[model samples]
Target chain A: MFSKESLDNLILSKRTVLCVGLDTDPAKIPAHITGTTKQKVMEFNTSIIKATHKYCVAYKINVAFYEALGMEGWQILFHTAEYIKSHYPQHFLIADAKRGDIGNTAERYAKAFYDEMPFDAITLSPYMGIDTVAPFIRRGKFAIVLALTSNTGASDFQLQPMDDGKPLYQKVIEKFSEKFGRDEIMFVTGATHSPMLKSVRSLVPDYYLLIPGVGAQGADYLTTLSNALNASGAGVLINSSREILYASSNDDFEEAAAAAASKYEF
Target chain B: MFSKESLDNLILSKRTVLCVGLDTDPAKIPAHITGTTKQKVMEFNTSIIKATHKYCVAYKINVAFYEALGMEGWQILFHTAEYIKSHYPQHFLIADAKRGDIGNTAERYAKAFYDEMPFDAITLSPYMGIDTVAPFIRRGKFAIVLALTSNTGASDFQLQPMDDGKPLYQKVIEKFSEKFGRDEIMFVTGATHSPMLKSVRSLVPDYYLLIPGVGAQGADYLTTLSNALNASGAGVLINSSREILYASSNDDFEEAAAAAASKYEF
Candidate 1:
């Protein structure tokens, strides 16, 4: 359970709002790690964590890359989460799973991430509505709903003009905020949509926003920080995946990852 | 890839619109299996598949249940998919994995289910927009998007009235239908919302609907069939999970599951 106060304390003490995204791809890793896909991914993750943990406050493990590998991939996911929890207890951990279903199914997913694996937060898709998300918001765990994604496809339903003149994403943020407080709920607002960050901040000024698309996806960090920063100067966790994880394909990949992470310091 | 014509042919040949949901829970399986979580789940799934495959045309595997057991669970999931594909290739396999993300991430998920596992179709959440869904609609594969789920939480967002004098679910159906044809896409409309089936049918009059919430969820089957059946008399694949999967807790569980499944025959 990463309380708002504790998250803020980490942000202030670490002097960084960076959340390293472990979107580890087996095809992209260096040729030096001659092992099975699971072994290579785990080794890569451990190295990256060892080098970058001091520079960032959180680690976002994208579930898709692991899911691509089948059962072996899932083992890597569990090991990675366990490694983070056991080694860096102070760092907030997120499973960037983007999962939601019916009430019963949602409960199982919540248990998978929160109880079985012990992640502090899991990203959720809000298409199925409130009940799909309610199961994730317990005492300490948080459900970060996708509001404005960084991709071009976000304009499909999320940016549609509703009857009230507000875009659909605003309605999503507003409705979710009504049910959860700053600690239990967060919104995934992409860095590409940095201009809209002010609008998002206006709606839920105190809530934490997990901003992605900063590095590899080519979103301006200065613009995002200018609009998304809250009164506490600690309301957003900017995630950089490929740019930091695959900083170099050489022997100094871990050192390169750490150097890239340090560039995101506040 | 389940073509509209082939799927319809199977529906007629099987003489039923039933899809047995393999939501195999380790805690719910009969004690006689006496195996590890992964082994027990695989055994239960195999038994149920053998018992009920003759009565139904499709098998919907809810990914969350398998995801709960970590990597071992995923191996069971793969084996289950393989069992159905090898022995009952006629049966339409739906990976009830309600997954969607950015375009690149969504592509990996599609490859995971379609290329890696050989599921005919995969359930998707459309909250992120068109790019999130376009990756899943390859040659023979189908992307069944969640429009109006059968859960109580559907009221939270899916049932909300849009500015165009239509519920949000209707808007979702309309937009998706415009982009993908009936062959490439399907919609998940819960059977519990039987009254809305008429409206949904009217919207996507030709597209197949993967309707859950029958049997155990207390949805009236006759009403659902009457409202959802299209001109071809094959427009819906009704999914019932718990009612059929856990029909008995004793030695007769497999026989009971078959008997329970036979009752849904049209």
Candidate 2:
């Protein structure tokens, strides 16, 4: 369980706000690490965490990658979360599972991540309404809701103007921010939309923004960091998955991951 | 692989469009069915499916409940999905996991549900834009997108009027419907918002509307069915989870579930 103050202290002590995304794909892991897909994924994840934990303050496990691996995917997911919780107890662990549902279902998801797993925060979609987000708003746990995303399809609805002439994403931030304090809630403002992040920062000045799309998605690192930073100089957790995880497709993949992660260190 | 034609054909043959939702919670299952939580969950799910298969044309497995149970939850989820796929191949299986992410992550979720599991359809949130949904729009599998949900929070964003004067959900349906054919897409129109189902039907007349909120959420089953039906007198799969699953907490739970399901059989 992490409060906003603890997150800030972690960032301040680490001097880097980089959150290495463990979007680990079995096929993409180094071929030299020999075993079944599940074994390889487990080894790859543990090794990556061991190598990169020092360079960053947070580790985001993209649940979809493990989920794609079948039943053992859940096993790997559990083991990875456990490994991070036990080994790197100081680091913030995030489940990059963009989950959302109505109240009861949302409660179930909260139980899945918060009680069953060792995640400090879980990403969620606020599309269903506030009830979908209500269950995740706890004292120490953070509910990182999706705001201006990075994909081209964001133009479809998120960036569209609402009846009030503001984009729908702004309304999402305003509505959620009003309901919950900055400590319990954070917003995912994509790095690809860095320029617009200034507007997001203005809406939720004290809230941390989980920014993805830096490396593989081609967003400028400094520009995103600059635009997304709050007055405290620590309100963003910029993530890089493919760029850092697949830095090298060889036995030295972990070493490469560390080096890639090191570059983002403040 | 279910197409629109095949789905309609199943509805015609089955006589009822009831989608029995397996939102199985460990704490909620019958105490008489003894075992570990996982074993009990599996048994309860299998029995529920066996008892109610005749009354419903589809089964929606809410992923959150299984996820709440930890690692074995995935095992039960897989076994339950396998049980339905092997026994009732005619039934449309929906993994009610409202997932959304960027394109690459979305691709991973597609593999997790479509390739790794036996789900015919997966529910998704459209807040991130169409890119999050693009990967799920494929050949036989349906991408059931959220539109006009039945929760009180629906008033927050989905029901908020867009600059175009139409609610945001209308734009979600209009945009997605234009990109993907009704054969590959379905909309989750909440039964609680039954009156608005008429407007949704007008938007995508031929697409299947997966309606929840009927039983436990207090929406009238008959009224939802009437409003959501299209020109084919089909296009809706009304789902009832708690009302059917926990109809009797005693040993006769399965029997009670069957009786409850039979009531909805047209």
Candidate 3:
């Protein structure tokens, strides 16, 4: 069970809140890793896991890269999650698949990630409302809802003012936090939105925020950490994907990933 | 290209706006035709497509059910889409995956569904903003954004009042339609929200709306059709999943599905 206590313990022990994103692309990986795309992804992830397990408390596998490879990609996804669970029992595993659907479909998705694969958490899109999110929150698994994303398109609707004067993203965080507590739910506040982090923190201070866009996306670590950190000084999982995963396109890729991860250590 | 003309031709030719949702669950399929879960799904989908092609103009395959079966399930998804393209070339195909992410990840997702697979349209969650959705909208493909879902949870966020006195869903429709025309983008408005359909139609009268929650979900067909129809008299694809897929749990499931689908024919 990936409760708040378990996450907090990991944060304390690891001395860092880095959640390494394994958004591995076959074309981006080192040419030395031979074989099918799935095999190469598996090898790359395994090496990275072996080398950088100590520096990070969580591993977020982006589902898009896997799905792009077809069936073999799904196999790699299952294998990756299973590998992490068996090898690094202490680490939190996240399926960074921003998925949500109607009630029944959502249940099947929950079963796929939470039951079938053993991810401790899965990123969810709250556009479909609470029912789409409810299925993913059971069995001590967390559903990290997209709140204030760091992307340019976030301004389209997320930052739009609601009738109550708060932004749509704020309303999403408030509603989700109210329905599901900090344990069952978390918010994805982009590192690019460092200024908005305080506003988000003010709404759900107790809930952990899974932040992306720190390393490669050019979000400042100190600003994000200072603004979004909670009362316990541990309420954010700062993710760095390409900056760590593709640190070097060479045989020393694993060592480079470890080094990149070490730099994010708090 | 799944252009307005292509859709209009199908609607006129078929004389119906029914989009049979292939939310095929391995467990829910008939007991007679059996094999591995993936094979059973493929068999079931193939039989249903053969049986219902004359009644419905489109097929909406929910990705969650296929993803639940892992690697082999993805093969079935590909097979199902391929079968439709080969056999029923005139019919529209939608990947009801409800996927979105940052720009890079979204690009991979677009490649998976639009480039790698032959889906005419793919559903998108708009929470991540435009960059996440923009990648999916390309030449001859459609990005159907979630406006207001049929679930009870729609009240949680979609129906919330924005500062302009319009609900968030209205804002979403307005923004997306402004950026992308009726040809490139569509909206998913639930059949249950019949009254709200008028408001939605007012926002984007010409654009197509994918209406689910009919049949098994107990949404009134006439009410939805009356309020949501466009100037062409064919502006909605009323999706019926369980109602058409599991019309009968017996050996004659395909026949029953065909019969159920015929009921929705104009």
Candidate 4:
């Protein structure tokens, strides 16, 4: 599990806050990797992880992609998490499973991600409020709450004004920031919403922000870096999923992925 | 897959709206059921479902408890879903996995729950707006959105006043109800907040509401039933997990669960 200091040190040492997202879709795997769907996916994940580990300081594994593969998917998910944790201990690992529930259930989810699988951080939905987040706020573990997303649907509720005259996302960031420190909490402020990232940084100046939507979602990387970085020049984990994972749809996938990851150097 | 018409029919035929929640904890299993934790959990789930199926019109499987068990836990979950679905085809099955993510990721989750597992509905956290839910609103399937939860932290955000003077939950219900019909969507209005049930009923008179916090959470059953039911005399699936599940941590646990489930007749 990576703490704030450890994460900052890693970021400074690596000279990049690039968090390679393993949102691996089996259908997108190159035809060259022949086996059952599960085997293909496992091969793709390990290959991608091996190829891109040095270019980035973290790996964000989206649970949905593996889960979609059914029982075999869970097997792949478990193996993938272990592969990353044991093989690359220095890299921060995130379970991009945006799960939110009541307290008791939340504890189980926290256990599933942090204990069952070795994820340093797990993304959470704060709509059910702070108790849903409390179970995951352990030492050296982070509960990355969704503040403002990159999706267009973010405007539907996240941008809606509350009684305090600020948008709901601001209130979420404000409230959660009060409960947990920079070590135990981070906010998912999307790269597409770079201008708003300044406001997010203002609220929690030192806390890391996991920024998605850099490549496929069309957010300018330099703009995101300029607006989101903290005084230490290390506060954002810019994730590129499909852009790097499926950088090439052919036999040269490993090389293509490596090249693509290196191209996003901070 | 159970729809509004089928759910209503089942409720009328069974003369109850009870949804027995399988929030199974391995440690809580009876010592008499001797095996590995996975086998114990599987036996417990099968026995419970068999005993309570006659009394309840639906079953709500909380994903957290199973996910907590790690790899073998998923096997238990897969088997449990298959057991109830194959044996009790008439009952509405729900994955109480308050999952919320962006569009593409949401599609994969929808596939995981609805396609991979034979669930008729899934509970969703609506904070990310409609896109997180759009994937699950298919024909004969329902998307149960979180309107107001039973947790103490609901006051932190769900009950807060938005710019329109209505609380965020009301706005969520209003907006979602307009987009999806009664057959396609249901709201999770907690039983602990029964007084607000009238407001929810007023907004979507025909849509079903999955009410938690009934037994162990200490909400009066009669009050919840009277306030939440529609003109058709059916609309709520009142869920009771702990009280019914751990009715007796002994040899007679099966009969105890049946008796406990029958006591909560709508």
Candidate 5:
């Protein structure tokens, strides 16, 4: 049972909160690795991971990359996640999988992302209310719900006020945070939403936030962090995936990646 | 390349609308299947698929069964969906993976559910707003959003009024039907909400509805169907799992399953 304390400690000791985003598109995978399929994905991820393990505290494998390729993709995803767990066991692992459903339906989702995939945490959408989210925040694993996301379209409704005068996302964070969620719950805030981080920090003063949209998504680290944390100073899992992973395409790719990761230390 | 039209026609011709829920739990699987490892899941699902292909119109393999066991669970999930798809090529295959996310994130989620898994449709939650849904309804793959769930807690917020003075679920269906959706978007209306079905029907008259909460969950099919159908003769995909798949522990399991599947006509 990899606890949240363990993840937080890993993040602390590592000094690098970079969740190496392995959203590897096959075509974008180094040319040598493309045509070989699953094994190639594994080999490709292995090199990148091995090279940058010293710099990152987490590895976030987007399930879509593997799933899009069918069996080969899934095999690669499993192998890739397994490789990360076995090799960099101390690093936080997140199945960048956004899964949510009904209670019975969510039970299976919890199993897939938490139990089967063997990731420390999984991304979740809190749309169908607390029941849809309860399954993911079970015993050991954490469920990172989609709050104010990094994407440009988030403001369309996530920030809109509900009939109760609370914004929809605020209702999500406040309501869902109360349901069976202790340290197990986290939120996805974009680095781009640095402006709203202060209000968000006031709302969810304690829960961890898995912030995307930093690095290649053009979110500034210090500015975003300043807005995310409350009086507690413990709730920001600042994630920078793309810019860190592809910091350089040269033979010194790993070094470039490490440098990029180092740029976001706590 | 599996068109929604092909799936619809097959469902129409077969006179069955049952989406066989394959929520496989390792403890529940008969011991005759090997160890509780990945192989057993794959093997058990294969056997179930082979034995019950004749009776089902669609195989809804809830992602959790495989996910709970970890990597092996997903492998089983992938192979099972592929196996069932190959075995019953005409049957509509759904990943019953209720997935939704913010827009860009939703695109990745969509690829994972639709492109990667190759399921004809995938379940979703619309609480995040229509922007969160558009990606899933891309091109031809149908998006089954959770409209009004069957759970006791569905009343927690789904029926609450939006700013527009419409119930949240009604607004969701109406908004979904008018926006980026046509016939490709459907709703997951609980058969337990039989009386409320007509309201759902009147709201989105042309869209399909995947009605679960039958048999084991306790919803009368005929009554549910009568309420769910609009004047267009559309809507209603009644799903039954544990009640059908495990209808009997004896050798008559598949037959019992067929009997259950027989209950749904349109």
Candidate 6:
């Protein structure tokens, strides 16, 4: 099993906590990596990894991207995960797949992502309750639960109060921490909701928070980073996808990606 | 587009609605079919397909099954979905993969399962509300919403009463049917709660309910079928996975599967 110290060591040595979201949408990827065909998804991803390898501490490949392409897409996803693990062992890899269900189902999921795939972490939605989130934590892999999101649809159910009077997101943080222990878990809070980050850190001060919404969704990095740091001075893993990948469509893709990401730090 | 008539005609012609779940465990499969270690999974799945192709109208392969194998498993999944569509076009295919989220995300998911993978139906959880499920209910494709699941854990949130006093599952059914126009969607209600089927049918008389908790789960078909039929007299697609798949692992595995499933008519 991977220890907390082990994961922390990787994060520290990696220097930047910036997670390059390898959300390589075929339609959006630069024309050069994939000149003119339905193929080259994996090649595009390979180039993205080769380019951004040094700039980021972790790589978060949203499963939906490859999954949308069917077999070839899955091939790209698998190869990408493997390539990341073998070449850059220090880089923390995450399957940005927000999966959640029950114990038996969750166990299968844990096997698929943790035991099977080479991802260091995975994103989870805790709407199904504790059983849904608990199995992943036990495997010693990071289970990033949705704390708050930047989407307009976030108001649908996430922020709504439960019978206990506390908002659902608050209850999730409390319950998940109590059951799973906070270290093996991380919460995904939107970079846009920087104001709430201070209160989130105050609630549980040591755990890492995966903050999305810093790039295309428009969350300010400076405000989110400052507000989300816990008392122990740890929180807010800023994930930037489109901004980093699409930083430049030219031949200097890798350098452009590194330059774009170098502008930010933990 | 998959029309209602086409679905009906196909089901009738096939004369079997047994949705064999290929929740294929790499450990449980025969030693040889999984291939010389690496492609063992693909081998196992191919063997199962060849063995159990008849006596079933649909095959629901849980994404978790292949996903647990990492990229290789995903590769196997891609080939498997492709194989089923090409070889057994008559049989309705299901990616027992439960997917539902926001507009753009759901659109990608729709493309993943419906367009790319091309599963006739894909299961989804309605936790995020109707907007989350709509992107999946395209013209001919079927979106199976989780109405009442077999797991005891489903009782935690799904069957729990809302502040409005009605069970959340009921509201989900009413809302989903109203939005998706009833014809394009199917609800997952287990045979375990055979008693509840009557009430569910009263609410959704014309729609189909994909029942999963039969056989080992102790859902008796005789008891459930009587209670499940609606005004038009047909409802409930009873699925018995372990009962059908692992029935006599010694020899004649496919024959055994066919024998067990022969009782059910579409």
Whole-model Cα lDDT of every candidate shown, in order: 0.89, 0.90, 0.89, 0.91, 0.71, 0.73
Judged by lDDT, which candidate is best? 4
Error of 3 at B185 (Å): 0.6
Top model number, DockQ: 2
i-RMS for every candidate (Å) is 1.3, 0.7, 1.0, 0.7, 2.7, 2.5
Write model 1 residue lDDT over B162-257, tens digit each, in one string.
Answer: 677577788899899999999999999999998899989998889999999988899888889999998989978999899998999999998999
Order of candidate numbers by DockQ, starting with the best: 2, 4, 3, 1, 5, 6
- lDDT per residue for candidate 6 within A1-266, as digits (tens), equals 44445555655665566888887877766766655333556666777788777767778988887788766677677778888898987777888878876566688888877776777788887655666777787655788887777666565445555565555567668877776655588888776777777878888777788888887888887787778765534444678998988888777766788788887755
Candidate 4 segments exceeding 4 Å error: none
Candidate 1 lDDT, A227-254, residue by residue in tens:
9988888888999999988999998898
**Candidate number that wins on TM-score, 2 or 6:** 2
Residue A259 CA displacement from its true place in model 1, Å: 1.5
| Candidate 6 collision pairs | A112-B68, B2-B140, B33-B43, B33-B44, B34-B40, B35-B40
3 or 6, greater by lDDT: 3
Q: If scored against the real structure, what TM-score would every candidate get?
A: 0.98, 0.98, 0.98, 0.99, 0.88, 0.87
DockQ of 4: 0.86
Q: Which of the predicted structures, 3 or 6, would earn the higher DockQ when compared with the native?
A: 3
Tens-digit lDDT track for model 3 on A15-118? 89999998988899899999878788889899999989999999999999988877577888889999999999888899999998888899889888987898
Kindly list the per-residue Cα lDDT of model 5 for residues B104-205, writing each as its tens digit. 567776776665565778887675677777777656567888888888767756766667666667766766777755457778888888888888887776
Task: Please provide, for model 2 over A163-242, each residue's C-alpha lDDT reduced to its tens digit, 9 standing for 90 to 100.
Answer: 88999999999999999998998999888887799989988889999998898999999998889888888989999889
In model 4 chain A, the worst 10-residue window by lDDT is A1-10
> Is candidate 2 or 5 superior in DockQ?
2
> Measured with DockQ on alpha carbons, how good is candidate 6?
0.40
Which is the better candidate, 3 or 4, if ranked by lDDT? 4
- lDDT, candidate 6, at A45: 70
Candidate 6 residue B182 Cα shift, in angstroms, is: 1.4
